[model samples]
Target: MTKKRKSRGRSKGGKGRSDYVECSNCGSRVPRDKAKKVTQRVSLVEPTLARELSQKGAYIPVSYVTKYYCISCAVHYGVVKVRAREDRRTSYNS
Candidate 1:
């Protein structure tokens, strides 16, 4: 597993994850319905960089990847939009 980074309570540094916190970017609170955990790894290929894959019928995965809040529980949580990097693959992640 990748080593955990420290949370500045905003930009960085939080172990594994905690109950909840406010989204620094949006100042929105989120619920941390915790106890269970999820993990994933993704590659970033920016719009211009992802174009090549689109030409080949391949697509990059899109996600929020930003520190955010639950907007419900007044806690901190990670938010992702889960989209396709390309138009053709918009229906799925490649």
Candidate 2:
């Protein structure tokens, strides 16, 4: 059988494998490079209360929450959107 050409921009030389991370929504293992990462800031105090406290010279601490999603989960959750035909990259030569 003949070898199939790589459709993506990746070259077909190396091991082609990568580290994996668990998807936050589906719990599926996805390659680290392929997973979508989202980081959100979490505040210990409510915004209104924090504003009042800050006006009174109080400080509020914030933490960052990071989540990873697989391609399917990301698409389903709106993290990734389907692009129109014209908007898609035209790397493949027909």
Candidate 3:
């Protein structure tokens, strides 16, 4: 068998098994290591109100939202880009 990616499309290295997570968009079950996780910080207050409060020395609260996407959904939503044959074999962090 031939390998398409060096990591086999999963971040679990030397681990036997990994947990599964549901995709936020399609609601499909995908492995935690294989799924793409995105975290965004959302402001509780509106931009205008937050600005006003900041001037008054009021602290604005923000919430963190995390989303997981499968490979198909990740590609569809432009979260991850398709790599070339050579690029697939190399790690971007290296």
Q: Using TM-score as the measure, which candidate wins?
A: 3
Which scores higher on TM-score, 1 or 3? 3
RMSD of each: 15.2, 5.8, 1.6
Backbone clash pairs for candidate 3 read none
Better TM-score candidate (1, 2): 2
> Which model scores highest in lDDT?
3
29, model 3: CA deviation in Å? 0.6
Q: Taking the tens digit of each residue's C-alpha lDDT, what string does model 1 give over 1-94?
A: 4323122123323445545645444655443432112333445887677888888989588654434344332223433333333442322122
Model 2 CA deviation exceeding 4 Å by range: 1-15, 90-94
lDDT of each: 0.42, 0.73, 0.93
Tens-place lDDT per residue, model 2, 1-94, is 4323342322223657877899999899987766788898999999999999999998789999999988788889987676565544432233
**TM-score pick, better of 2 and 3:** 3
If ranked by TM-score, best first, what sequence of candidates would result? Answer: 3, 2, 1
Whole-model lDDT, model 1: 0.42
lDDT of residue 45 for candidate 3? 95
lDDT at 53, model 2? 96
